[model samples]
Target: MSKKNKNALGGARQILDMNAFDAGAEATERNPLLERRLANVGAATVLFYKEPLEIVSASGSWMTAADGKRYLDFYNNVPSVGHTHPRVVAAVTDQIARLNINTRYLNSVVDLYLDALKATFPAPLSNVVLSCSGSEANDLAVRIAAAASGGTGIIVSENAYHGNTSIISEISPSALKRGNLPDHVVTVPAPSHPGQSGSIENAFAADVKRAIAELERRGHKFSAFVCDSIFSSDGVYADPPGFLRKAISEVRKAGGLYIADEVQPGFARTGDAFWGFARHDVTPDIVTMGKPMGNGFPMAGLVTRPELLERFCEDTGYFSTFGGNPVAAAAGMAVLDVIADEQLQSNALRQGNHIQERLRDLATKDDRIADVRGAGLFLGIELSQPGEKDQPNAELASSVINGLKDRGVLIGAAGRFGNTLKVRPPLSLSQDEADIFVDRLADALAASA
Candidate 1:
């Protein structure tokens, strides 16, 4: 509930600020490799912690740094089934040894994988297009929306982050570094309220309507209203199931397609549902997924109605050099099998609830803990001034993040002001790992105080 600060840190820049790193004079002197990394890695690379942990190996929910210290990981979600899962590894290895090529040839593996992937979606979302990353998937979704709706205008959340492609970057407000949004794009506030008065949904929908009107005023036809279902970059707003229904309806009324960006909350990470949009009881015209889809393997895709796919293809045929390759298919299939056999969805729900309950108890003792909100394994803890709950405490968030790293735990921050702690561990995290994170977080809070 904090008021917006104009000068606050925004977007991925906050994640890359040099002040957030822990490379002290002594630590830097001991590790010449840090200088080597700086020399080789691009300036755009975003590393975690003040003194970056040189992670050497990982397994399950734990990772070992070069210092011979093992830290409990509470940040990474890409390894949904868990880090270095034997089944996923074996699948990729076997496929690599047999065959690995583009989708041009008649491949049974790709066919079988496509069937398994489609089985995860609703009946109408029968067509699939494979890509190599979430950015590529989103880029394609935007093109499809423009083709299907014959509109160039796109709407997104205030701090939404879709991808890195040029077209997608124009639609992603979080990726914008200067001036107002591009002429063809507009934004609406995310649904962040807990629905104390049951007005949050209506207010959000109204915002969407206003944005649509503004776009029309500027002589741009509405194309799509894309959103990350959990609103991760807008500070994790997954509450009051069906809150997104009204906004989606508004988009449809405006003759715009609803593109659900499931890069963050897909593949059973949300506990009760496989897709974040499902929690709202609505079906999007296009669904794009990435990150955890291949369990660390490079794979992403979009699923949409067959009509939309056909319309898009009629304009310009699509083909990806590395998309849906045999190895990627093997990895994707293995990830699905692991999720089903291991019952990760149920585990996500149980552990997420337990962690939230523990954090709520901590909130009772610490006034700085302004709010705790999220679903399943993806959650956020909002920090604010002790007396003024409307003033975000980014300094405290930064301190806590660094303190946790010092105590052998890893996490990150998100939101417009970088005041919300983002906790999205792998779905395979154990109850004991959750307890460890809670304890470490408690210690980090104390240290920050």
Candidate 2:
């Protein structure tokens, strides 16, 4: 084949082999359930593992598969509190039985939930707009920013995955399957420090400033700079507190609003702060939250300054039929109660520190384990080729992820090169659970080796 054809085939192979769970595994047997799912579900639906685990039930930090085996979950951040906490279950059940209605009517439950949610944010972020999912919240945030700033340009990380909405997908460079970024959207490199020295903060700020200038050159006025506060999809970079201050300032100076997408790192998962942006001490103009909002309930929302919200409302009247319904409010409230009552945040801090300490020790012995960095429970372990530091070894990462699954532990990968193990577990993970995770991770590394 010609060189160009060979390169095209290599690219196709890379995409096909991107599944972290398919490495070092035997050929999948034909399962009847798998066949049924394939027939019904779209081709875009991705499943974990070459042989997918049929998870039947879950609790706390463990899930029971159809094979009657329990796996320690380190992949799911959606269950922020835990998998089906009794309080959340009871709250949803009770609210459904009592009354479930939209926010159009006067509802005491919604009011109480709103009050509790607002208390978590800074005073200026008093206005809230509830939505059904992170995608909707992000979509609305973009709209609000555009309306408030009268600008159409947006800035995002190179591999950011903000949401799945059409507008959001355009800005989410990771979601773009083909073609360059849209004219109105510009992407900056994620805040990552591999080998390059100097301040990552200043570097990031410079990138933001350049993106804003480029947007202006193209006659697209800057509207917003949106990012996953923890840089989750860009491989979970949460270090050097206050690193984001410079970039946020650049966005504000460029007359663009800062929208913090807290879908992955919110709700005390970071342990250091309730929201990931809080760790950087940067107050976003609009904060979009989801995934862990209701401890797995289909709930998300955006918190913003009252003036911006008022301007958005004036531009386009906003109403969500099922956004802040009584049931969702009840579930959200229950999640908050569980977070405080169970002291999950403190537990996350303690366990996360322990895990990172153990992993750092392991890294000293393992050449392939390039870097172990994160804040609280949101962590990433970068894999590299043996003896070649900083050279991402995506194949090794895939092998380790699949190996962990075979050993009854669940995990995933992230980053532009897909070589960073994304280790985000439930906030309620116990010390014992952390020990299990570290042990399994060590074994998985060995297996990969």
Candidate 3:
């Protein structure tokens, strides 16, 4: 943590007299919505609502919750742009106030939306289909994949989380609840540092080979190898891009389409490239995007080769009532425009580098930190158990998250072990805000230690 950040945090606290508000473990004891939402997530009592500090409004990299508290939000990766960015808000408001309609009726917004979207992809994937959420997009992708290959079998990573939709859950290993296993889906271990002897790339490649062998033995062909570009739910394994590339190659050779789930790592969140799969130097057969594209307006889409889309359409009509509503298209357009005009991608590069360096420094100082990994703003700090070499420390990660919250920063965790501190703030985050987050995290780690 830098001295300047320490002073800024201190000044902010002093100005608000932050201690006066009940910003602690029991802060949400009185708020019904906070309490209900907590219980709804099955993480009851895992969080608290701060009051007297309720958020009233916000712009750029900040957020005002409901109780007057201003949070330097670092957990909202879905809002690819900063919160309430004027450009986005203006576009949506203007469009809604003027004319908001669905895709059934042709509109200028739809044309503008698709034109802007085409620039983001390679030549082959030029067709577009819109949905209201990433889950729907994934569901549609599954249907398209199955239809294209004439197979029902699909393969996914062990801890991969595509979406909450039922058909997608049938293939998502991360959706492993009691009595919730789906048929016809082959599961494979995600790429990770395997047992200290192999790199994540080696483990991933080996797993891909084994999976393909099993498919052959079973005498079944797969339709798709669907996976997130950055497996956020598995862990921050950003290295070895060609690892997935190799796996996709094998799957394609076996007559399956390569599907890249870019819900969490798209919109230039990764520093090296705009799309996470680009880092692998692989062009996917189908690329679906959502979450960050509309800055939380609930718009998702899939881009694929023109011929493949035509084949899928031959069987059934693909349609969604509110998928590409004018309002959503406007919001999506605004996000892209802001990303380009503001150069948030460059900001992500600069801040992500600083964040990785700082986390690595902290990892050196603390043995509990087993690994610090990721690309661009989508980074993770994995904590280790006391006597384990590679086991994840879920409890310690939870403590760090709560402790940071107590100190005025909000973050989330990921990975199968639940031991990774996920840090993905809005793209508008400034260096000053990053410095504040780093300080809070360092302090939280030290206190927990």
Candidate 4:
């Protein structure tokens, strides 16, 4: 293939593959379980690190492998509260034992959870639709936007990965490897701040304006502008809070709904606010969230204005067989309880800021560490060629990932070029754990160099 074609293919790296384990393992690296996993999943398996760990159990901020090795967990966006939090565990176990049934019949636990969940959002977003995954929530949001706006156009960030469903995959540019995006879908560059300008807000808004015009020219009516408020997949760009307002304004002006895909950054993950979009000061027309909702339990959903949901319901029926069962509701309620009772949100803010400060100090000394930015625990350390911030150094990122793993810390990579270390530990991460991670990271960077 031509050079440009090869570059295009390389740029299409899927979100999960940034630090994924290749099947081509050396003989010494292969074990019976690893062999069985490969044989079972075949080409569909997506493991982490050069030597994937067989995790047997987990707790707050840490995971234990089958061989009894423990690693500080920093790569999980799920279980935002923490892994196997006792409150969530007790709640799920008790509820499942008592009664487990669908939402077709009235259930107090479900309503209580729904009410508690709604209390977290704005008043206008009163209606909630429970679902089984973030993918389902996003899929419904897309249809609702189209139904309400009478439009088919959708816009997303260049490397956005919303979900794995067929419709969602079409809109998720990072997931498309062998084909061009459908005409109805278009992408905008990620919001990048060069450490010297407040121009990112205006520039991103202008990009949205141009994307809307492009959609119009393509004969597709603008439906919705979907994105994670943190822009996690687009390299964890979160700064100058309210930078998204202008772009969201453009989306609204064009009669397109703004759908905040909070699957990756919601439920107090962003510290400054309960929801990631809250940091941006933008009101999403439809907010979809999952993964952490049940703290690893299978539950996800969307919240929207009543009128928009009413409009969508008029066109089609909606229900999920396992969406808001009592067990899921119990798990959801427990997650909320843990976040509040233990003050995990405050902890996340403190620990995240501490790590960011340390990383920033390191960045000042290390030319290869390009940038340190993110909200709360959802932070990123961008790697670049030494003394050349503009040039991505994915190789250095890969080296640091393995190095960190060897140092008893687990992390991952992100961004379109896969040079940014994605640091998203549990909200309950303590200062000591945070310090250990940063120290190990410094060592890893030093050793890699």
TM-score of each: 0.95, 0.94, 0.88, 0.96
Task: RMSD for all candidates, in order, please.
Answer: 2.3, 3.4, 8.1, 2.4
- Candidate 2 has which clashing residue pairs, if any? none
Tell me, by TM-score, which candidate is best.
Answer: 4
Model 4 RMSD, rounded to 1 decimal: 2.4
Q: What's the candidate order when arranged by decreasing TM-score? A: 4, 1, 2, 3
Query: Could you tell me how far off, in angstroms, the CA of residue 23 lies in candidate 4 after the best superposition?
Result: 1.0
Model 3 over residues 77-174: C-alpha lDDT tens digits?
Answer: 87778888888899999999988877889999988988998898898899999999999999999899988998877788777788878898787765
Question: Model 2, range 396-427, lDDT digits (tens) per residue?
Answer: 88888888988889988887777889999999
Per-residue lDDT tens digits for candidate 4, residues 1-449, read: 24574374354466777898878756554478888999999999988987778999999999999989899999887988889998899999999899999889999999999999999998999999999999999999999999999999999999998998988988988776577999999999888943234588888998888999999999999999999888888889988798999999999999999999999889888888999999987789999999999999999999999999999999799999999999999999999999999988888888889999999999998999999999889999999889988777888999999999999999988898898999999999999999999999999999998
Estimate every model's Cα lDDT from 0 to 1.
0.87, 0.87, 0.79, 0.90
Instruction: Work out candidate 2's RMSD over C-alphas.
Output: 3.4
Off by over 4 Å in 2: 1-27, 194-197
- Give the per-residue Cα lDDT of candidate 2 at 338: 93
Residue 395, model 1, lDDT = 85
